[model samples]
Target: MLGGGGSFRGGQDFFGRNNSNSISRSNKLIKSPFDNSNIPPFPSSTATATADQPIFRPSMDTDPDPEHSFFEPASTSPFTKSPWSSHFNSDALPSPADNTSFLPNILMGSLVREEGHIYSLAASRDLLYTGSDSKNIRVWKNHKEFSGFKSNSGLVKSIVIGGGKIFTGHQDGKVRVWKISSRDPSVHKRVGTLPTLGDYIKCSMRPSNYVEGRRRRNLWIKHFDAISSLSLSEDQAFLYSASWDKTFKVWRVSDSKCLESIEAHEDAVNTLVSSIDGMVYTGSADGSVKVWRRELQGKGTKHFFSQTLVKQECAVTALAVNDDATFVYCGSSDGVVNFWEREKSLSHGGVLRGHKLAILCLATAGHLLLSGSADMGICVWQRIASDHFCLSVLTGHTGPVKCLAVEKDNEVSEGERRWIVYSGSLDKSVKMWRVSEQPPSTFQRSPSFIPECSPTAGLLVNAPSFVIREQ
Candidate 1:
């Protein structure tokens, strides 16, 4: 479970419930990835220090004690004997039959600390920023700890970067602004916060600026609940934040002014993304994904509800769109990934069934799509035309994968594209992987055809058009 603290809904914890169990919580007490007994000691000479005393624990390479290992001996099959189990192999230990070449190669892993699990991640250029429940944000460059800063209150939940500034949404219902110092790039300073002091005072005097929230009247410019996700507009002119308060707010980036707040869902909004086509997509615990279109109305922008892409009994936990915004993927607590295609008028694309537990986070790099699940595995899918194929499964995390960030590997050749994928997990660690866009071989194999089962209906759903190459 995400032990620190957060909001909950519908008798379900913050991460939602799968079969009435918290998806992010595991009863298993496995050895830490950084356990000294299982791994070699870190070389002090390679450890970098910063003002905040950021610690960089190396990745786990040695074998773990079997009694304390999260992975168990495999049965006859890799997947569970459930209707939802995918045909794609998911063995705790990959066998020789599985094509090792297709798998995303693990680059390294780092333990943030024993106290806080990583909640969010943002990658910009060569720098990777990680946020956690400990109220700290740490920066890494070239897989080494570079710098860090602390927040007085609230665990960092979501982070986004634009215009050389980093925006972090917190559990305290405040969005903080940070910038690197002009003289020292390693030193980060908190410059301002969303709904700044000036805006709060200006809105407080007017009764019209207050809205009923959480059984109390609060400023419409402020969120009274934890901010679950944050996104910036394609043009970087506006910032969007979705909160457990069931509303999504828009702020002008230049002046840090709240422009609009819409009650987007009946329950908490878990994820939100602003696409390049001027459309905003939000998924929530309400079990629906909604789309909105923003337009200039007078001096401010107004968001008009466009459509609801999905509505189900299971809560939608994550959302991601491809580079061109041609496809939108939604992951629900039922361990299914549903997608839609813009060319088909955003119509329902078939589900990408793989994970046996809740999918907590998702990311995209070029034609590659990555889905992180509570099952402690990452599925790498490649998009070809309108269909998707599961290339390989990357497994290592001992807890629910909480967040993901991906950037192109600039060092790769022009003809060969590779992506650097960073996955943050509730295991209090982050793992890096290198993924190739193309398959290792051109040889083709027939894909497995498994019947899809709806979470609530118990009946077979649409047959997926996706293929799972023999692994």
Candidate 2:
């Protein structure tokens, strides 16, 4: 945890011995949070730690007597009255920007866009997808707008990209699928939807009279509530959609078929993370983290309920798994990040504490665990071999940070790798941040901290289109 007397503790000689020290710190190596069979000491303001021993403290106070209960509650349902209002033409598409004029004074390395209430964001090899609370879902490349699509029914809550397709989860209880048309790259088609039920039979992508008829018959196969989040399998062959209806349904990506539905939690399923090897992780408002497995048995497939992590009684708000599948982060409404490990059953690692409110989103880039909170702040933590601790605190957004995505690229000028952070907030904008090795402030202006050239130094010029308008 970052301390009260917070002083920025980073910056070093670029390409010098001093860089070694910063790398060790950035690695965030430290003692487990649960050191002596108790909650390990929270990273004080004075020090930081790393991810090792997979130490997570199981809070006796947070975990009440547990029972096998997967029932759904009506009061806390994700299917409550939706705010979706149909307004735009279903046939009309988003037009290209009038010009490629760059936003004035646009921080070269850091970008801030004025897109509305950017709820969800995704990135492919070169293109970026921005999902807004409004009707538009914009696509950008090299920081310039490429194309966009719109949905009049609901706010886009979650998005995932795979297999040349974009899957979006909307508050209107629908999963919309899109693809860049082969015939027209500039035009993206609403290729398909999940649980199409009758729509599958209608053989049409757009809404039609049969939509309602198919919807009625699809109740059993579709999510009956708001889709909170979506995840794709390692091979992108399977797609998972979790809902406020306390259930998560599995779909076959090749055909948009609803394969299975599991009543996951007693409360709403808020977030989920998936591993490439058929491991599905789900966190719910019921304060539990359950693991599910999807496997193929010859020609047939199956989803097996695997394990559960009930470290706290607070709602599990966000989740992240490390790239190597060694550590699993389960963030709760009470501002705790619980760690888990693989190996058949889970290893109770320890909890990470810093946020004043619920943790809303998490992204693990290299050894850095970036956490966004309802407190309108993002905390960057380092995880090296053992020294784990907080590295920086970013404060600017007026609203809660809801989503985060990270992209890494080589910084040719700095001779190192740089991480560009893309954050989506209820504030209706997407902000970009550059994290790289830099020289100490006292010596000289570090090219990593702030560019000496244009604000887009350190290889941000290579970032895909969509620069922010200057304030």
Candidate 3:
């Protein structure tokens, strides 16, 4: 059993019930939040400087009368007379609005849940979209509001939003597009289905022969296996997909035609991300990450593709890019997070280590990176002074955290800096935390909102098509 404070108890039962008769509460219970009695003693000094002995002093008057005080008492006490008294009234504590905007940079919010585990999440403007293993897709307005339309069918693995439409990849080897009109609640409709490459292709055509012959290309939707991941260019001109068939394909969304296909990895490509610099990065189960680039020909022909970069180790499972595109962060099943710069080099700038199990998801905002892992925890890291680093490990989830979404509050009032992290876990719940000067000492377990045995395991937001499934 995975418990708070980094302790793992195995061999009892997988269902989280302790069956050992010898187990005692004192032995099973980990450190409490108030256990701060441990402290190292300081060394004694033979020579000490007092207040009257100044290290350096000007020739002017440096002393003042002791009775001339510079302090005054505040109107209220910082702490109440009783600990429980503070909880009796909401007004007893200061509101978040009263704090300075630039401090306490981390905030968290929990969104509504679907019938199953959330696998992927995407955000656009005021809408939050989620895809789940329950073969359902759900949309919510802001963090507090929920929308009614949910799809029914295969597990939604990947999702992307573009051209006022959402595109979703399903485990059943289908891609559906949906048009979302918030103005009319009843206007949500499926628009089209993309091709699936579920089997082997026997024919190959040269780029020139197909373009000059004006041949209509078949949709690459025929996947030999399940669609594992999907990504779109910054401009949404092309859609790229990675599948269990060991091939990555690029499709033109307008025509729904396969633009190019490359045998990018030896195993299933589990994740894909496209950068603003026109580079496509794919992470595979083969324990490697590959980068693809598009080559435009002189003639008006389809774009040719080639591999430009690769990481031979670390089965990359998730990816996130920094706000400035200066760095790319890849999370792997090896429990390591690698950072790469944009210079076509294979060197890593920094390695974030701490997760005991496979990292399943990652999200980035500004200089901060958030990672979710199979170890049932979230780790936050920030780039310090451009080179140094600091980390804060957040423990809470009893199961693997599969997806995360970050919301940047650019319009927060002065003195109030704000950022929200939304995470989806296999525990069947979402959690919210308020970030302050000190990390929270205790991890609170969220109540399971979705019933057990739901197939929801991944999340994809801002996708056009929705999916919902039962376990």
Candidate 4:
């Protein structure tokens, strides 16, 4: 339990040296928040913590209970009226030159306290899927909960929607597949599980197919630890799943066959992003980001080590590749985002300093790069030419922001582009915001320059400056 002072402790232990097998054993290692036995400690300040210290907040006599019953009837009702609305005040808008080019307003906010913390999110068309530690996946349409389903075990950690099917990665190291019924779009049926029973059986017959894991011989097709992230190929013909087991597995979308598993990192593989150019980027707890090039060999594909993009002491926690794959961004526990430009032969671009705590997730919608951090704040960055600058800092969640999903907004004029952004937090709530792709000319400003180079940051030349626009 967290103290009333809201002081954070056990900083390094959260990303400790020990590479444990199961997430449940350590309260520090990222795992299911509903474990009851191992809920990660929460801090109150939104942007107080720094890379080298723990976060602290003023004490309060009545510190709200951070833990809530997963079955709390009042907060669990999906049909309850939304407790959220736009935070944007058109009449009271700030000066464009000092703040965001245009106001990005929150469309709605829903507190699903009974379902546990939202760990992952996926947006496809008009539907939104949210996965939580309660093992339930809730489907939302038009800002209302339309339907939902549950996994018998394991917390849902990651989700991806493509090829007319939905794939969810779980803490139990299994990937579950589902499809929307043609008769009723809301009816999501479990189509199959990865490494289908038949495939598992056939592979088990050959002892040579087994790989050493968790002190036992497990099939090479299976993940022995929690599936931390999921990504899809450009054509949606293949799927990628990263896990805490230190490997990323490839699967054929059509047959759900386990195609390949690469020992990509030495520590827990936290996130993976696949690009259209046959390139895959993976971030790991080992504090390294490696690039792999995919090559077609017969009907199967093999990945070759292309290069190690950036290696540092901070664990790389999240990754995002822009729509065109022109830039790749890696977020770390040190509260900075390191980027590489594809044009510069993947040259190391300067770091973007926004959050004061670990950045847990990153998402890009057009020219905007949104980063959610453990500091309970989301920083919105807009890219102009070769530079990036902070446009806004979204604050509402009282706990660490965990995951994010964004989709294009077509309702606006064709001349202007916008996106619908969904940010999930450990505060047991999800906030939806509308963001413009381009900052208004009056609001446009270059990132503040930091002249000193950081050895860990690697060649900090002309990195984007950060200026927080108060909402």
Candidate 5:
């Protein structure tokens, strides 16, 4: 079940950290509707609070009641659309830019390029795959560029790289699988194509259509109306597909059969991920996030329990699970990033507030969280010794950053482990950032590292190609 609500107001203490009297007093001082003078600055000098600390007070009046909230009427008002689109008309606010003041010796890089905006990104091993609006999926190995992989007839919406294969969801209502081999970089082949119901019918009616006389198998699952996103289980046994039809379908990959289809969301299920413990987390355009867990019985039957974890003020756009599987991070349409810890009951671990526009993507490794936002910036947050989170904002992209992939490199230096963050943006390029150090105190942006683009910078002009072979 999913919930809906008003526009997101970042740094406004939605959890009610401040006293009610102080909140009332501050609200009265700000007269204009657009005035932000009422919002109090986050305390800079306070010590970090423990996870058990009651930092936020859930509002009984405004908070969605679990029983009644799921049945509430969907908002159709144009004014109440996603908050991310609302703030786009206005100038984006700049985040703190001084990297030296917060963390020192941090480096950033740029890797991939495309003619259009990047929609989704996934990385496995040493390879990176980026799905873009250019109707091509590009592969990057090491720091060098490789050939683009073609996917669906329409724009490539999302991609996931795992099991030595690349899975892509397209706007044309088709999912494509490509097999990649390192031995041959110049050749990539598409192995399978899973088309939607209508497309399947069309292909069925016209039987003899291939120039190569090769039949492409369509792993069509009838339940998913329009595939929005996909995720594979830790063991790669189950494939989870979220759809615009507001349901999530779990398919056993061995048989390509739909095992279960749950009404998991109200709006489009835009993002989904699975933990190693068999927990599936989904985010939707309905402004809510839900967690699904499979309940196995002695009778060899499995049941799923879907629960709403956090109801936000805007649609949740992205989700990532930590390596430890202790926390789940979600990025929302309001530019707010939330961390939820696994416990007897799910609880909000912390909130990172800085992005001026909607957060587009989030990736986590170790204790670090990397987030890309529609504001054309990437922010890095590190959990410190005192349980407080430190922030480092990276700025370079001129357009909205749509996706991010993290690569762990252990062979670079002795006991020197680092994450290479690959960010895809609407500015039509992929930028990289290396997070090396944590700030001793608060963060301050350095003036010397301002990002400026050259006039002759080229975008990715290569065609999308995928290696296809008979299964």
Candidate 6:
């Protein structure tokens, strides 16, 4: 931390963009991340330091009595019935079998109160938000009633949370923005809309010079169909809306202005993910994955087509990128996850084949890649030392798995780190899975803490440099 109160205080300073003096929230700073400058030292007298110290007793649970041990165990692991029951064969990157273990488990399930399919999902401070076929977007706090926002338009298609705002794309071809009130976080205020277009009369009012006549014409032109997905840059500077009209439009977050409209796919654009480094990856129903690079042009940004990948003629259903953007994971309608390396030339990485049905969503955490599918199952894959293999299968969703989000545990040690996965399905429910190499305690792990994992460079690629040779 720059001022050394704590990382949270440092984050508050970073995210709030507040002055260094005001960002501390009254916490005393000891030193900075770089140079260790000291503050005033306390008096070293024993009488002065111990004068007001109060002694607190430890709880009975820690009294070292064998009777204090909690709960029964040793018979079966909680994950036994859930597919990711067994431990992994090894930590090395050797290829694993069909039933190979990744040490993942379905911790809990949060079912929506409304009877509709969940289409999209996002995670905030301590709650998980879901957009469904219904008019309401439900928020889940461990399946308990938290808070919700209602929509008047068509069904919700995609959702993203960033920059203290929630962005939702709908089937009605509109992107709406909502922000948490500084007074009450549960209360959201509708702040803005994207590509605000009017009918014949409203179109005439937009200044031709301000909104390019071609852009004004193309604003409503694209996204007349349902918005299938939404993504945001790591810095939250831009929001991307992908639609069934085979196009994706980029918008500036501050002023709510449309920047570029790209006819991204021959078929519908199903999923997209963007990075802070100005790279955008889009997958389409046309069975292709295209990378668009955003270049700074004067005061604004411009997206230029970089490369096209995957020619299997299978609809590219989902897309995922690693923490550092070294690898791209593309899932297809044929249940194949293709890996690509972003180097001199985009390397065609190896393929992960596990699911029997089309893949609907993909998420990455630590060295694990989770693929949700139309087969009502989720397959967990582990990458180690460049070896990739199917870890386990989680089968509980009654319907096709639509979307999922992962939060990794970064504060813990390597083997102890765990990531929480919130998955939304057409089964009218969202299931939470804790994927990790090891458990935290004998009891259940806490969900309130966020999870993070180290950068992984071990995903296999199909290129000659990544070939798998028999021992």
The estimated TM-scores of all candidates read 0.76, 0.66, 0.64, 0.79, 0.64, 0.67
lDDT (tens digit, per residue) of candidate 3 on 1-471: 000011011112222233333122222322111111121211211112235431111121112311111111111223212211211232332346653322242323333232456666666666666776655556555343334233443667666778878887776556667776566542455666666322223223333322211135433335555576777777787887776555677778776666676667655566777777676777765556677666666732243344434454444567776655667777765566777776545456656775777677877766667778877777765553333233355555555677776665554556544455666665544544333322122212223312121111111122111111110
| Candidate 5 global CA lDDT score | 0.54
Model 4 residue 65 lDDT score? 17
Clashing pairs for predicted structure model 6, backbone only: 93-384, 349-461, 349-462, 350-461, 350-462, 408-451, 408-452, 409-451, 409-452, 410-452
Instruction: Provide the clashing-pair count of each candidate structure.
Output: 2, 48, 47, 2, 20, 10
Which 10 consecutive residues of model 5 have the lowest summed lDDT?
65-74
Which of the two, 3 or 4, has more TM-score? 4
Give residue 183's lDDT in candidate 1 (0 to 100).
74
CA lDDT, candidate 6, residue 342:
71
Tens-digit lDDT track of model 4 for 154-209: 77888889899989888788889888878766667787888788999999999899
Worst lDDT run of 10 residues, candidate 6, spans 1-10
The candidate scoring highest on TM-score is: 4
Task: Order the candidate numbers by lDDT, best to worst.
Answer: 4, 1, 6, 2, 5, 3
Listed per candidate, the RMSD to the true structure in angstroms reads 12.8, 18.9, 22.4, 9.7, 19.6, 21.4
Reference-based TM-score, model 1: 0.76
Q: How many backbone clashes does candidate 3 have?
A: 47
- Evaluated against the true structure, the overall lDDT of model 3 is 0.51
**Worst ten-residue run, lDDT, model 1?**
65-74
- Provide the lowest-lDDT 10-residue window in model 2: 1-10
lDDT of 2 by residue, 1-471 (tens): 000000011121111112222222233212111111122222121111124211111111112212111112222334331111011121232122312421111113222333356668787766777776654676656554455677653667788888988888886678888777786565676766776756445544434322222125234466766777888877788888887666788888998877777878766677877875678888865657898887788976888998787734455667888777767777665666767666535777656666776677888877777788767677765554422345445665666677887777443244444466777765554566654322112222224432112211222223332222222
Instruction: Please identify model 2 stretches exceeding 4 Å from their true place.
Output: 1-115, 197-218, 343-345, 412-415, 437-471
Where in model 1 is the C-alpha error above 4 Å? Answer: 1-104, 442-471
Candidate 3 TM-score to native: 0.64
Off by over 4 Å in 5: 1-108, 111-114, 181-185, 195-220, 223-226, 296-303, 385-388, 437-471
